[model samples]
Target: MYWRTREELSLENRLRRSYYELLRDELDQFIMAHALKESYENFKNNNVAYPFVERKELKPRARIPKDEFSLHNSFLVIFVEDTIPQAYKKYIRFFDVNKTTKTNLLRSKTLSLGPDFDRSQKFLDSVHFYHFLKELLPVDYALLIQRDTSHAKTKHRYYLSHFHVRIDWPISEAAEDLARYLRYISKDVYEKGEKYAEDVQKKFFEYHALPDMIGGRRTAASVAAQYLRRLPFISTVYVSSSESRSLYRYCEQGVSRMVLMRLTTGEMEQVADRNNMPVRELKRFYMLDQNGRGGIFLFRVTYGHTAPAMPPEDGKLREIKPELFWITVKYQHLLPLPGIWEHPPLRVNLIYT
Candidate 1:
C-alpha cells in the first residue's frame, strides 16, 4: 500500500478525492434518471446504442486529471499542440527571435523612465484599463500577428500577431505557470528596450495584477475558496508566483498575527505540513509593514492569456467570455523574534461557490 504522510498529502489531492466522490453520485443519479442502464442493455441487444455516449477507450490526451499535482504548470504544451496551426509553424519559428527581441527592448525603455515619468503613469493606467476590459471579455486566446512586406517589390506583407489563449484545465497550477512565463517574457522585454516593450509590460501587468487590485486581497482569497468548494472529489488550488506576494502579505496580517502569538513548535510544524512545505523553509521573510502587522512579504504574480473581444452582432445573443488568467501567491514570514516564524494553518472561508 502506498502511504502518504500528512505533509505529503497535498491539499489539491485531497480536494480531488472529494470532488470525485461528489461527481460519482451525481453521475449515478443522472444515469438512473435517464434510464441509461436499461437503454444501454436494449441498445446492446438491438444494435441501436448511440455512438456518442457509447463507452470507448479514452484517448490519453483527452482526459484531464482531477488533482492539481498531475496538472502541468504551464500551457505551453497545449498551446503548441492545439492552437498553433500546421501552416504557421514555420513562420512562427522564423519570427520567434526577432519578435521576442523587439518586444523586450520596448519594455526596457518604458521602465527606464523613472518612477515619476508621465509616460510610465500612462503605461500603468493603460495596463489597468486593459485589465478592467479583460474582466468583461471572455476569450480563450489573444493572437498577435505582425508581417512586413517592404522587402518584396510587390510589397508583400508578412505579419504575426501574438496569440494569448486560455488554458482549459481547471487546475490553478496551469494558470499560475502561464502567468509566470508571461511576466518572465515581459521582464526580458523590460531589460531589452524593444519597440513594443511598453505594450508588453502593460499587457503583462494587466493580466497578472489587475484582478487582485480590483477586488482586494480578501476577494481574491474568496475566489480561490469558491474553486475549492466545487470539488466533486478531491481538488486543491495552488497559488502561483503572481499571487504569492499579495496573499502572503494579507494572510500574515490577517491570520499569522494570531498564530504567531500563541502557537507552539509542534503546532507550527503541523501547519507547515498542511501547507505542503517545510516549516523552516516557510519562515523566510521579504516584505514589512510600517506598523509591523505583517513582516517579510515576498510575492510575485504570473500572467496568462487575456482574450480579445468578439465582433458584435445585431440580433444574436452575444456571449462575452470572461478573460481567463491565473496567478500564484508565494510568501515567507519573518518574525520580530531572533528567528523567523512560519505562518500558521490558514482557514479560508469561501463566500459563494
Candidate 2:
C-alpha cells in the first residue's frame, strides 16, 4: 500500500478521535436516561432512598446491596417516623389522637406535657424506644436506627429521626397483637373515660406494617436493612448471631432467664452472659471496673442465625463496631439486647439505655 501523507494521517486521527468522543457521549446519555427512569420507578414504589439519589452532595445513587439484605428469617418489621414531640402535631399521621383525646390532653393539668413529650423524643434518640416497644409488643425485636435524612434528601440535615423494628413474632401474630392492643385502648377510653388516654397514645407512638417484598420471599427487615446500609454513618444494621438457636430453644424449653441472670455477678454480668460473653471479657471491653456504671462503652452483641460468630482478634474489636459514630459518641452507653429483655421470666431487666 502507498504511504499516506502526514497531513492525511493527522486528519484521519482527528476524525477518529471525534468519532470516539461522539460514541462516548451517546453511551453516557443512554446510561443517564436509564438511571433516571429507574429512579422514577423507585420513587413510585415508595423506595425510602429514592429522593436522595439525585442530590448533588450525595453522589451515591442509593441501591440496596444484595449481601446486606440476606437475612431470610421471617419477622414483623414496622417503620415509625416524624414522632418527635415538637413535630408530632405537625406530623399528626404518626399518632393522631381522637378529638376527645386532644381536648382531654389540653385540659389534663396532671399530665406534664413538656417533660412527657420530651421523654418521648429522648426515648427514640437513646434507642430506649426499641426496648419499650419490645416490652409492649412482648417479643424479641431488633432495632435499626437511622437519621431522617436517610429516608429522603431535604434541606433539613439531622434535626429529625426515624427507625425500623424487627420483631421475632410472625407477621400475622404481630398484626393481630397490635390490633388487639389498639382495640383494648379504645375500649378502655370509652368505658373508663380515663384522663391518661392521651398519655397512652403519646407513649404508644404510631407505626405501620411493612409487608414482605418479592411475593413474600424477601423479608421487610431485610429490605429495610439493605436500604439503611447504603448510608453507613446514618444507619445501624443488625448483625445476626450464630447462636440464635439458643434463644429459640429457650422459648421452646421454658428456660428461665431469671435464673440465668442470677448466675451472673451483677447487672453487667447478666448482660455479658446473655450475649454469650464471659463477665471478665465484658468488664475489660467496657472498662466497667475503671469507668463505673456510667461511662463510655462500646458493647455490641449479635442475634439471629444470619451469620456464624467470628470473634475478632484480641485488641481489634473496635474496628468492627457499627459505623454509628454520630449516635455512639453522644449516647455513650450499651443498648440492651432485645432477646434478653423480651423474655417475661427475666427478673433482672436489661438496662433500657
After superposition, candidate 2 runs with Cα above 4 Å error = 1-131, 136-144, 148-218, 232-234, 239-353
TM-score of each: 0.18, 0.21
lDDT values of the candidates?
0.27, 0.27
For 207-313, candidate 2 gives per-residue lDDT tens digits of 21111121121233333333322221122122221111001101111111000011124666666666676766655543322323432222221122111112223
What is the Cα-based lDDT of residue 68 in candidate 1?
A: 27
Error (Å) of candidate 2 at residue 49 is 44
Error of 1 at 177 (Å): 24
| Span of ten consecutive residues with least summed lDDT in model 2 | 251-260
Q: After superposition, how far is residue 332 of candidate 2 from its true place, in Å?
A: 26
RMSD of each: 26.1, 25.7
Q: Which stretches of candidate 1 lie over 4 Å from their true place?
A: 1-98, 101-281, 284-353
